[model samples]
Target chain A: MPYIDIQNDLPGIRGLMAFSPHTAEPMGLLANALLHHSDGLLAAERELIAAHVSYLNDCFYCQHSHAEIACYYLDGDRQLVDQVRTGDDQAAISPKLKALLRVAAKVQQGGKAVQPADIELSRKEGATDKEIHDTVLIAAAFCMFNRYVDGLGATTPADLGSYPPRAKQVAENGYGPHIFSTSQPAGPSVKPL
Target chain B: MAHIDLPDLPGIRGLMAFSPETAGPLNELAEILLRDNANSLTRGERELIATYVSALNDCFFCSNVHGAMAGHYLQCDMEGIDRIKGDFASADIPAKLKSLLRIAGSVQKGGKYVTISQITDARTLGATDREIHDTVLIAAAFCMFNRYVDGLGTQAPPDRQYYINRASQRAAEGYLDFELYKYK
Candidate 1:
């Protein structure tokens, strides 16, 4: 179904890292900070940004994966995740997050899409400078991530349950341990030029 | 400086879901997914993928914000976020990430830009299906996000501190508690 070959099974980035332990380190570090680090954006909001962006990009893997994690923090409400995916602004989210999502949506369309009023509105909603900045960052980072998966034609799990535990682990442990999965390689790793 | 106008803040979508109390439910759900959802990708790497794509897309807000996030995850020795934005190929990152970045690049160009061999190459460098999947999603999503921001012409704060301080809080409290502004 994908454009390329990917392993049938194996955790998220873990299998890829296993293919090349050395090369996976930096990614692991990035994951460590973005997901687990204390100073970075909250894991839930990060996932929301990821999910929202994935929805916009039509990246199935990201959409499904983050959707499940979102449910976990949403008191196990899957419908809410679905609502966000649909871009239903009236999806019962907070004004702040709604504003942030608007910014994220704008960012997904392109950075230039975000207007000055958006910033003022976010500020009015108590979205601090860092939150606004991170919202944009979250949108931007997910774009690269979306392309990486879709670009390579990597394996995407049919089962939504497959991603949450992994997400939780990455949230807790970081990327170092799973870079080079001890298991056999299941997917291709496209090297960046 | 942006190419587009930021869509109505609290426009149709938010207005439809009016009331901060009512909106709390959605924010709570989003918060869990954004910050709490765990994955194999390290915080820095995920943020790096985000930052790299932002740079590629030329979304200044995302590039700077996520760059700082990636920097937060890195150790004292590495350039971290700078390397990702400056030159992913030579950023002292792992071979797989380099490979992943390639995939990310292709996504930036277009989904069709990614090739089978690229996947193999990334696998050769130790990438998993989930990692690859996440990469694609991140790249693809960022494209939309970049467009959203750029498309709407959202404002970028004048100072880096604005981004840094806010980012730290979002990093700490998640999205639910951070809601500060409200509209009639």
Candidate 2:
């Protein structure tokens, strides 16, 4: 049960997004621009980064959902996805991704937690400035997202199996239409400040 | 100097310029979150929420810039904003705002840190579901902004006057028109 009556049966951020279509519209766009689009990083690599951050934050829904998307792009490598999420050094991922994850972890700890050496390491491993920037943003965005979902005590499905289906759709279509343009009216009548 | 080769403009301004693709949607979010008149929150109240979260994150640039925006809309001085940033509970503001600030502070600590009592408290004080909803988003969004600004080793000038002067122009211009609000 969510802290507020969001008036939706959808789990996690979906319910929250449905509750606030206004914020959802841009947030969905941000997700599209950040994770779904082609960039210096592959969509799988980007989803992997997002999943890693979500795992660090302990956001079960976000981690699993994005991890499944990542798995879709990584030749369905669930084991590799798990390795990336756990920060296992022996994971088969490239050195550039490992370096980027280090930076992402630091951003998860705090903004200032990311140091000069972290950036240097990523660049040393062949991470571009754009890749580094997006990694930090993805990590930082997940922190907010984790807090939003948990802060509201948003509903989560009891079974992990429930996520992969939605994950498949998310992987196929990206985030915009999935989250935005809901038929539900936005929640709550606010008092003027 | 930043960790990357960002434009010479300081803080998020330069970072956004570096990636126009992400910048467009981000600025749109900012404009709607802070400046939307339909919100029950005054732009000043919403800015204060941003200031409080940025301050808790110890993000000097975000704290000061949004702090100034809060002051600009609320007609308070920098010191007044400082008091709110320092301890919003003790600041001379409405009971409703105090509760909202408390909620935002919990969000700064972590999402799960926000309690059921906090939600109930805000409700008892007359915050609507939308207000609570936006409050969480504002706090969450600032976490993203704060990290982006500092995660890249962006410069945060210590001079308070620069932010203070910029606040008026920024308040008039809002966040979307990135070209108008510039400082190095």
Runs off by more than 4 Å, candidate 1:
A1-13, A37-41, A171-176, A179-193, B1-106, B112-184
Clashing residue pairs in candidate 2, if any? Answer: none
Please write out the lDDT profile of model 1 over residues B1-184, one tens digit for every residue: 4322323442212211322422343344233223445667676677677778878888777676666666666642225566556777876778988998888777787665888888789888888876776677666656755554454345565565555555555566665665444321
RMSD of 1: 13.4
Off by over 4 Å in 2: A180-193, B180-184
Residues B135-177 of candidate 2 have per-residue lDDT tens digits of 9889989999999899988987789888998998888887888
Give the whole-model CA lDDT for all candidates, comma-separated: 0.60, 0.86
Q: What shift in Å separates residue A147 of candidate 1 from its native position after superposition?
A: 0.6
Best candidate, lDDT: 2
Evaluated on chain A only, model 1 obtains a TM-score of 0.78
> What are the per-candidate TM-scores when only chain A is compared?
0.78, 0.91
- Ten contiguous residues minimizing lDDT sum, candidate 1 chain B: B10-19
Q: What is the lDDT of residue B14 in candidate 2?
A: 85
Query: Residue-wise lDDT of candidate 2 within A1-193, one digit each (tens)?
Result: 9888898788889999888877887888889989997678899989888898888888887888788789878877888998998778899989998999999999999989999999999999999998999999888888888888887888886676666667767777789745424442232322211
